[model samples]
Target: MPQQVRGVIARSKGAPVEIATVNIPDPGPGEVVVDIAACGVCHTDLTYRDGGINDEFPFLLGHEASGIVESVGEGVTSVAVGDFVVLNWRAVCGQCRACKRGRPQYCFDTHNAAQKMTLEDGTELTPALGIGAFADKTLVHAGQCTKVDPSADPAVVGLLGCGVMAGLGAAVNTGNVSRGDTVAVIGCGGVGDAAIMGARLAGAVKIIAIDRDDKKLEWAKDLGATHTINGGQVDAVEAVQELTGGFGADVVIDAVGRPETWKQAFYARDLAGTVVLVGVPTPDMTLEMPLIDFFSRGGSLKSSWYGDCLPERDFPMLVDLYQQGRLPLEKFVTERIKIDEVEAAFHRMHAGEVLRSVVVL
Candidate 1:
């Protein structure tokens, strides 16, 4: 029988989300039903609410979530009922061209729960990142539930499901920061701060965080940034060059995803350095640069989609890192909120007041 679960839903674009009854069906083949424990409020959720991502109104918002498997559909073997798990948006299909080429992280054909979760009035709901999780229960493909250390705080560990993963992977996976390397992350928001932590985890000798806000730059320090540059106070490129002993950082990541910041990252990177763009940009945003610079940069300029992460591999490893105290994932959680507080959380996030406000179910 389908269960009526309490969830936050956006009834229309630009409308505040509301707590509504949603029907989650028993897992169909290859799917599983998760009883959500906690979900983090991310900017992506706010984007969906503001119609930044698409016209998909009535979106079931919130994707950074941790939960327990209550039921598994046939052929689901990745997890068992009762497994504590983090919900992931990318459920890679092994048969995709990317996966077939031994790059499952780039799998083109990811999937979600086979059945549509619906509103009380039977309206189909578009889930944020295909893993709507601001609810008591949600459904996802079997591959989406990555088992983790149950002892870890659900509010914190769940973050590995999205923004945190994107940030961490942007450093460890895309930028390929190594020990003794100088790394700079522009934009000290949650994603950029996570990049700072990831560089530290990867043993970066010099980690520079750049932002306009002093408060965010200070927060970046708490997250392991070795240096913070107020872009509003100084030219980011000049500060980066000076901080790196006249040479720019070995890797510079643009977490703001704007042309100006991207250009700063491009110029602030040392020759043969890597630049990873993990920050999301709007569709109207266009980047213009000298074609010669692209050729002259001499190394990789990569855009990471979902941090090039394979949920099955990355999520569990991140949870273990959090459990082992190697990654201070818990610091990302600024507050715990009720489902109805999402709008307020969005405001707090916009105001740069919190790293994350999680909803505990």
Candidate 2:
């Protein structure tokens, strides 16, 4: 029998999400049911509500989550029932071309639960990022369940499921930040702060954080940034250059994703330096820059998907780090609220009042 649980859903475009009864069916083959303990409020959820991701209405709008595997279906061998895990959107199908080529992080085909969770009237809902988790329970592919240290706080470690992982992966995996390198991150939201922490973990000598909000900038400093720049008050590129001895930084990450911020990252990196774009942009947005600049940049310009992370490899390590006090995961959780407060959390996120307003079940 399907279980009926309360879930937050975007029933229509640009409409506020509401708590409704979601019917989660028993797991099918290769799937597992998770009893979510905590789910973080991410900007993507807000985007889903605004019709930014797609026209897919009635989206199950949460993904950054931590939970325990309640049960497993046939052929699910990787994780068993009762395992503490973090849910990830990308469940790489090992046979995909990218996976076969040893770059599973770029897997073209990812998996979700074969079964659909529905409304009482049987309206099938699209899971946001393929792991709709803003509820008491969620169903996902076995591969989406990445086990982590159960001793860690669910509310803190759950953040590694999305925004935090993306930022860290952008700096470590994509940008290849190295020890003693000078780094700068533009935008100090959850993602940006994670990038700062990643750069610090990679042994960066100087990590400059750029953001328009002083509150966010202060938060960035606590996350390992060596310098902070208020972009709204000063020229971002110039500040980054001056801080990096006029040669610019070795790696400049754009966590804001807008074309303007991307441009700042472009001009803020030293020659032969890398630029990693971790921010998500809308389809209608376009980039316009001098063709000559692209050629003269003399380095790689890359966009990261889910921070180019292989959850199985990164999640446990991050959780362990958090447990050891090397990574301050708790700093990301600004507040904890019930499932029904997701809409209010979204508003607070938009107003830049919180790094993350997590839903604690």
Candidate 3:
């Protein structure tokens, strides 16, 4: 039987999201129903609400989430009922060229629940990142559910589903910050701080955090930053260069995703050092830099997609690290609120007042 549950939805562009009754059909083949335990109010959700993602009206928002499996459909064997899991947007298809080539992280084909969740009048809702979890229950492909230690707090571990994972992966996987490396991360929000933590975990000797906000810089310090730079006060590139013996850091990560910040990141790394872009940029944004700089610098410039992570392999391992008192995943959760307070949380996030406002279901 179909189930009716309350969910947050963006009805139109620039309109505030509202709680509405959503219909979830029973799982089809390779699908599963999950009882959402907690969901993070990510910036991507706000982007969906503003129609920045697409003109898909009535978007079912919320993707970074943790839940328990309630039921599984035919051929679903990855998880079973009662399993605690973190939801992920990427559900790699093993047959994709990327997967076949041993890089499933870049799988060209991913899976989502084939069934469409709808409004009372049967208007189909596009789930944010194909995992609408800001509700009592959400339907996702079985592969989207990555089982982890059940003892882990959902409010904390669930963050691995999105921004946190992205930041960590940006440093460890994309930036390849090895031991003794000097790393500089710009933008000390949730993602940026996670990158700082990742750099520290990867044995970076000096982690420099750059941001406009002092509070965020403090947060970065707690996450493992050895030095901080206020971009608004001083030239970020020069500051990073000065901190690393006038040569710049070995790896520079731009988490701000703006042309100016990216340009700063470009020049803030030593010659032949890496620059990793984990921040997302708007379509209208463009960069005008001298072509010769790229040729002369001669180093890797990569953009991290979902931190180039493999959820099944990364999530569980990261959870274990958190449980062992290594990763400060809990620090990322600044506050917890009811699902009804999502709209207000968006405002708090915009003001840079919170790292992450999780909705505890």
Predicted candidate 3 versus true structure: per-residue lDDT over 128-153, tens digit per residue = 99999999999999999999999999
lDDT of 1: 0.92
TM-scores, in order shown?
0.98, 0.99, 0.99
The model with the greater lDDT, 1 or 2, is 2
lDDT of 2 at 202: 95
For candidate 2, lDDT tens digit of each residue in 1-361? 6799989999999899999999999999999999999999999999999998899888998999999999999999999999999999889999989999999999999998988899999999999998999999999999999999888899999999999999999999999999999999999999999999999999999999999999999999999999999999999999999997889999999999999999999999999899999998877789898899989879889998989999999999999998999989899999999999999999999999999999999
At residue 133, candidate 3 shows an lDDT of 91
lDDT of each: 0.92, 0.94, 0.95
Lowest-scoring 10 consecutive residues by lDDT in candidate 2? 280-289
Sorted by lDDT, highest first, which candidate order results?
Answer: 3, 2, 1
TM-score of 2: 0.99
Among these predictions, the greatest lDDT belongs to 3
Candidate 3 residue 347 C-alpha distance from true site, Å? 0.2
Worst 10 residues of 3 by lDDT: 49-58
